[model samples]
Target: MSLPIVIIGSGFAAYQLVKTLRRQDTQQAITVITASCGDDYAKPDLSHVFTKGQSANDLIKMSADEFAKTYDITLLRRSRVESIDARQKTLRCNGESIAYQQLILATGAKALVPPFQGDAMGRIITLNGLEDYAASEVELKKAQSVLVIGAGLIGTEIAMDLASADKRVILTDRAEALLPSLLPDFVSAQLYQSLGNQGVSIELGTQVESLRQAEESIAISLENGHDYRVDAVVCAVGLRPNIRLAAEAGLKTNRGIVVDRQLRTSDPHIFALGDCAEIDGNVLAFLQPILMSANALAKTLLGQASNVALPPMMVKVKTPRLPMQLSGNTANADANWQVSASREGMTAKAFDEEQQLIGFVVTGSHMKQGFSLLRELPPTF
Candidate 1:
């Protein structure tokens, strides 16, 4: 009897990796272990909650049984990988062990809950996985007014979803603008105004002071000493990659699990992808990057030693109300940019001193230019 190839997650990264590997070698004895139910689903659908009119149950695209039967792969549903013995190449789980010809860590990231006090016992939710979403959905049903803490992509999306649901939504952030890391000030202002038109309250340049459980609801204390009452609170603050496991195993880690172009970690037999990995200091938290990483890693698993090179990845922020297509490494580029705005949408272009297009943000229907700009962008090595 031979050991199976073990994968430690079922998110976009792990799912794509398994799907690609199965296509190349169906008899590879693959086993997927997930902390969640191992249900197959597009995680990004969580943000499209309002537009899709989906409940927590309806949001799930596929079940574990469906995936297992469809792929003829073994699914260890709702199992936790306690730790990995990298030197011995084994993963331990509940008095049992699994050996792998190769192991991939797609463990993903956890939402960072700020150090604050309040009815901190689950009244406040973070949308990181199915379980978290399920819990949040229940609270959302009872919430007439919702408080969202953060103005980043996830936070803004959730705020829009809640507002679309007719829930009075209040959003706050430490940055002066929404999606500070992804969009320019003017573009963010455009989105802020758009959300306002949709009846969302914005609180930029503010932070959460504390949270307190009021009668039959919660009160969110703001840094400016202002308190707002809301039926539910969602901490869409941000995410930090789950690298403790990899770090504990003596594998080299930086912002994420540092991987080579082949998606191989410091240990040759171990590989990482998704939010938990930082390939050449690039931890892409988008769908396109995840798909690319999966494809590249799958080739390596099938005995092809190929390096994965990425083009400037484009992301559409599912704000159907705002309609935008944004792209490039907007988060890390230290360069000047040009902004063009009209009734159509705003186009913000970042260029290097050498006059190379590095990043861009296109809002509303005017984002059609993204395809043309994407073709002209350089390879993200």
Candidate 2:
């Protein structure tokens, strides 16, 4: 009898892992459990729905039942795991204990919302998962204005979505510009202007101090002695790895559940991937890295002792208002860079001491060089 495989979490990693594994062995029994509704959708697409003229419902790629039927695997939608016993190879859910031969965790990350002063209770949302998106859609209907707490990729995308829906949007960040996590300073300037031109007021270098409730709305106060009254607030600060379960199960963990190049956790019977797993000491929160990790993990499950060697994975922002792609790590100390910028666009390339290209950033019109530049970069661990 083939051993039953159990997979936790239903995100890009989980879906792709199942697809890739089934392609190699169709008869293996597999089960997927998720806490949220199991309609598979691209997670990034959640923020840019309005720009693409797509509805929240339209974003669902496959229903849970359909996915299970299509892949010949069991799909447990809206099911939550309470505990995992790694020694016994058992998982507890809703008072039921299930045994598995091997376990895979695709438990993705959660939005990080810093603690701030506010009414003890108010309408605040985080754009982390599908449920969050559905809640945001409902909040937008009743909102006349919105206060966004972070101006990173997700925050900027959410602000732009709200603005396009004709709601007054105010985007604030502790950093001095949008795309601070991914784009360089010169590149950010163009994005700042582009968003500003579209009526999205950016309040960089500021933090949300508190939220005051009004009779019919809310007023958002910043630490810099500024106040703006708005209808609702959305927090998109950043993401934290979902590692509590793996940690509690006695698996080795650092910033995330530590995994090797083959995506296997400390326990050979257990594996971890996606935003929740730290591979080669790197927690990649981007799509390309996630895809590459899934493919490599699947190959290992198919009886190959393979290590996933990642090329410099590029980060692409779908802010159609300002499309940009960045490849490789920009924080390399051993590399010198040459930057080219304009009011419209910018490009920067980091070259090693030996004159080999190591990393790059592309913004606006220079985004066309993304592929060529990444092709020249050295492989990232």
Instruction: Give a tens-digit lDDT track for model 1, residues 1-381.
Output: 667778888988898888898889888888899878877777788887755667778867788899888888878877888889988889897669888888999989999888777764367788887778876786787689989998888899989988988899999998888898887666777788889999998998989888888898888888877789899888888889999889988898998999999989999999998999997787888888889888988888878987888877788887767878877766544768888888777777888888888888787766888889888778777
Model 2 regions more than 4 Å off: 331-336, 340-345, 352-354
Count of clashes in candidate 1: 0
In model 2, where is the ten-residue run with the lowest total lDDT? 328-337
Using alpha carbons, what is the TM-score of model 2? 0.94
- What tens digits encode model 2's per-residue C-alpha lDDT throughout 1-381? 766789999999899889888888899899898998887888888777655656678888998888899999988888999999999999998789988988999999998878878782356788787778786776666778888888888888888777877778899999987776566666678778878887987898989888877877887788888889888888888888999999999999999999988889999989998999998788987888788887888778867878888887878776777777888766465658798878667788978788887778887898887888888887887
Q: Which regions in candidate 1 have their CA more than 4 angstroms from the true location? A: 329-340
Worst 10 residues of 1 by lDDT: 326-335
Residue pairs that clash (backbone atoms under 3 angstroms), model 1: none
Instruction: Write down the lDDT of every candidate, Cα atoms only.
Output: 0.84, 0.83
